[model samples]
Target chain A: MLTTLKQHIEQLVPLTDAEFAQIASFFTEKKFKKHQFLIQEGEAAPYEFFVVKGLVKAYHTDTDGKTHILQFGQEQWWITDYQAFYSGATATLAIDCIEDTHVLCITRANRELLCANQRKMEQFYLKKSSFGYMALQRRILSLLTTNAKERYEQLLLQYPGLINRVPKTLIAAYLGLSRETLSRLS
Target chain B: MLTTLKQHIEQLVPLTDAEFAQIASFFTEKKFKKHQFLIQEGEAAPYEFFVVKGLVKAYHTDTDGKTHILQFGQEQWWITDYQAFYSGATATLAIDCIEDTHVLCITRANRELLCANQRKMEQFYLKKSSFGYMALQRRILSLLTTNAKERYEQLLLQYPGLINRVPKTLIAAYLGLSRETLSRLS
Candidate 1:
């Protein structure tokens, strides 16, 4: 599990054994069963989770009680109510496991401390954040310019195997399409 | 102009005069007239601009030739085809002046060099990138969950002065609403 994290970090910045050890110290591990919520809306989101195994999703429920999936987290992916985690606000999004899950969790304090203490870790996170921003920008563009069919196709292309893993209804929600529309498109 | 950039940087990380001078050395200043493009689709986006004066917008034209506004950049804002800029790809979005604009620009190489040489600058970028990611995440959620009227109201609340500054058509595009619909909502 630690090796999974070390490799993820190394994808951006090379880490020595000692450096990896120091970086690993900041994170604690946890597990969840299917349908278990890692974050519940209106609660404090104290930690961000990095998935080592299984799947999870972060989503918002609208005033009408419709769910809108924001993102799905697989192995090596990070999931949280990031705004709440960073700003100390109550969570507006809920996260739950799709499969039995294991994740490494880091608190806001420890994340800041790790970045402050390790320049390489700061660079790693900087790269990750930039890539994350770019991905969201693409999603926004897709939402603005594409129809449901186009979006479904684009998602299929981008994530390749994701269609097989994520529930079709959840994918429909993420694309802002009804399940019927998604089924027709697929 | 340098003071503008200094103040922006200092918002995240305080810098000594000497350090500021070194950091400022990497950027070049440029000005553009209204409707002039800083970045054009299909060309390489060589620099990311930090607006010192006036306004700019970045948008993409779909296959049907409809323009979707991705973002508007005002004073103290940064604008670029980020996917192209970061990945060495050709521009997919075009950035053009909405008002006669003055900006400080930095190339990818210079940005990398600055981060490598200055730990403070790297930290500054890390913080900025994280905030940028969070903002995009909120926008994604807004797109997924909100109705046109709700989105219009949210945008107005978040950027009170922006509604008046940007043209209604662009705002409509940004909100994914028809101009008539936006006008009715407003």
Candidate 2:
């Protein structure tokens, strides 16, 4: 688990062993069964999870009784209700496992504490935030200009080779299309 | 000028007088005429600008010779090429003033310096970042689900009374629709 975190951090910015340790200090190893909720709506997001093993999805139901898949987290990916985790608000998103999973969980308080006490940790957080910002920017652009076929292709690119790992219906929801439309395209 | 910054900060987290002064200390005021590029693509983005007066648009031109307007900043709003600013990469986005403008600028180095030296400043950064995160998330969802008309309406709702302040072509680009389509809808 620690090895996984180290690898992920290195991809963003290289850190010494001591610096990596300071970041690892905030994370605790956690296990979840398939179909378990790591987080649920209306509760503060206690921790953001880094997947060590297994698949997970983050989603929320809209007012019209529809479920929208916001993100899917596989190995080396992180997932969280960022608003709830950062602002002490109730989550609008819920996280659930697709398979039995191992994760590294870091709570809001611990994450902030690490940022305060360690310069390298602050740098890591900065990098992570910036990358997230960029992804959001790209996703917004895609949402504006791309068609369903283009979106599906992009999603496949983002999660490469994982299309068969999950249901088509969920993928349809994530693409903001009807299941019939996805079937036709598929 | 300071009053606008104060009001903007207050909308996030209310600052005491001293706290406001500390926040203000990081900013340097500057003026620009219409069509001035605040920062251009392929140049490193060194600072974030807060608009005290006038209008500016941030955009990126893709390989197809099409522009994507990421956002626009007017009074009480902030703008930057966040990816380039945080990562020190050459900017993928560019900014230009639509009219005469005054801005308060803070470089990447000074932002880090301010956060390191002041707890209040760190909190302020955190609050602003969280808001940015939420806005990005909403943009992602909007991209997935909204039609052109619906998306335009949402943008109108977000900017409120600022729609008339900028050009229709840019607004159409921001909405991910052709100008003719936007014109037809309008």
Candidate 3:
């Protein structure tokens, strides 16, 4: 599991074994069963998690009780309520397991410590955050520009395995399409 | 103008006078007239810009010549075709001056060199990128969940100075609302 974290880091920056060991020291491993909640709205979200196995989702529930899917965390993905984690504010989003899950967790302090001590880790995060930012920008473009069929196709292309794994209703929410519209597109 | 960049950086990290000088040396200042293009679709966009004066808009135009506003960068904001800037791909978006604009531009190489030589710059960027990621996440949520009027209100709240400056047609495009619809709400 630690190897997964190490490999994820090494994808952007090669690390010496000692450096990897130091980087590994900041993280703790945790597991959850399918359908378990990892974060809850209005609670503190103190850590960012890197998935080692299984699936989880982050979402926001509206005052009207509608749930909107924000993202899915599968193997090798990172998930967190970033606003709350960084601001030390209550979570506005909740994360729940879609399948029994394992993740490596790091607090903002430990993560910053890793960055301060291991420049490679800081570089890794900068790259990750930049890529994540670009992905969301593309998502915004899609939301503004694309039709339901185009969005469905883009989602499938971006996450080839997601359609088979994520519930159809959730996929509809992510695309901002009605279930009937999504059914027609798919 | 470089002082603006220094002030923006200092908002996140304190810098020695010499450190600020070294950081400032990596950037070149550029000026654009209103309606001038900074980045054009299908062309190399090799610089990330920090706006010191005036406003710019980044957008994508579809096959049928419909424009969708991706962002408005005013004073103290950064704007670029990030996809192309990082990946060395031709830009898929275009950015243009909304008013006569003055900006500080940094190429990725110089940006990385600065980060390598100045750890604080890396810290500044990590914080900035994380904030950008969270802002985009909130945008995706608004696009998914909010009605036109709610989105309009949220946009006003987020960028309090925007409504008076940006053209109504562009604001409507940014909100994915028809001009007639936006007129009704406003």
Candidate 4:
């Protein structure tokens, strides 16, 4: 289990065995059944999870009780309400497992400890954070300028594997398009 | 001059005098006249600029010849085509000064050196990058779900100072609304 997590960190930066062990100590292994809530709106987000197996979705609910899918996280993906995590404020987003899942969970305290101890660990987190930032930037640019069809095409390009993994309605919600519109386009 | 740069870096992470000097050594100061192009589309983005004075805009021109403003940089803001900066790719975006500007510029090579030397520098950049990403995420969500007027309202709320600093046309482009539509909304 540590090996999987270590490999993911190594992809961002090379870490010595000791360094990896230091990093691994922060995470506690967890499991969730389908539809389990890993996080909830209006609660303080204290932890972020990395998927060892299965899938999860992060989403927000509108005042009207409509759910908007923000992102889907599968194996090797990290899931969190980062806005809340970073701000140390109440979460506006919720995370839930779409399938039975195993994860490595890191609490806020542990994350701080990791950053304090290992230079390489901090660098690894920074690189991972940068990747998330890039993805967010691309998504924003697309939503601003692209039409529904164009948005779908870009989504296809960005997450070719995701189409097979998640349902169309969830994809529609992620794109902020109606299911009928997505059905027509498809 | 160094004091001003030190303050800017400290906004992200508090740096000791020695650490600040080490990071500052990588930057080369330069000046540009108003309306001068810092970067042009189809060229390599050689360096990222740290503005000490005046304003700059980064934009892209579509096939229709209409320019879309991605971001505006005022004093202490970092400016570059991040895609080019990170991947060593040619820039699709162009950057230009709106006013005569003094900037501290860092080459790609020097940037790598800074990251290599200091874990704090890496973490600082990561924090800066994450803020931009968070902004982008909010912008995307707004664009997809909100109308032009609603988006304009959001722009005002999110970047009130920027609204006053830039022209309506640029604001319109940034919001992905036409100039005429923006005028009508106003």
The digit string of per-residue lDDT tens for model 4 on B1-186 reads 567889977888999888988988888998999999889889899899989988898888877787878778888888888778778889988999888989999988888789989867887887787777667666665665677889889878876677777788888888888899999998
User: Which pairs clash inside model 3?
Assistant: none
Against the true structure, candidate 2 reaches a TM-score of 0.80
Ranking by DockQ: 3, 1, 4, 2
Q: Write the per-residue lDDT of candidate 3 for residues B11-101, one digit (tens) a residue.
A: 9999999999998999999999999999999999999999999999999999889999999999999999999999999999999998999
- lDDT digits (tens) for residues A23-106 of candidate 4: 888899999999998899999888889998899998887767878877888889888887788799999889998889899999
lDDT of 1 by residue, A1-186 (tens): 899999999999999999999999999999999999999999999998999999999999989999999998989998899999999999999999989999999999999999988888898888999999999999999999999888999998876777888889999989999999988988
Query: Candidate 2, residues A1-186: lDDT per residue as tens digits?
Result: 899899888886788898887778889999999999999998878898999999999888877778888888999887898878877889988999888989999888888788778766666666566677777887776765567898889989989867988899889988888999899888
Please name the candidate that would achieve the greatest lDDT relative to the true structure: 3
In model 1, the runs with Cα more than 4 Å from the true position are none
- TM-score on alpha carbons, each prediction: 0.98, 0.80, 0.99, 0.93
Candidate 3 to truth, TM: 0.99
Candidate 2 chain A: minimum summed lDDT over ten consecutive residues — where?
A119-128
lDDT of 4 at B151: 88
CA lDDT scores, all candidates in order: 0.93, 0.84, 0.94, 0.83
Give the per-residue lDDT digits (tens) of candidate 1, residues B39-101.
999999999899999989899999989999998898888889999999999999999998999
Chain B TM-score, model 1, reads 0.98
lDDT of 4: 0.83
Give the TM-score, chain B only, in order for the candidates: 0.98, 0.94, 0.99, 0.92
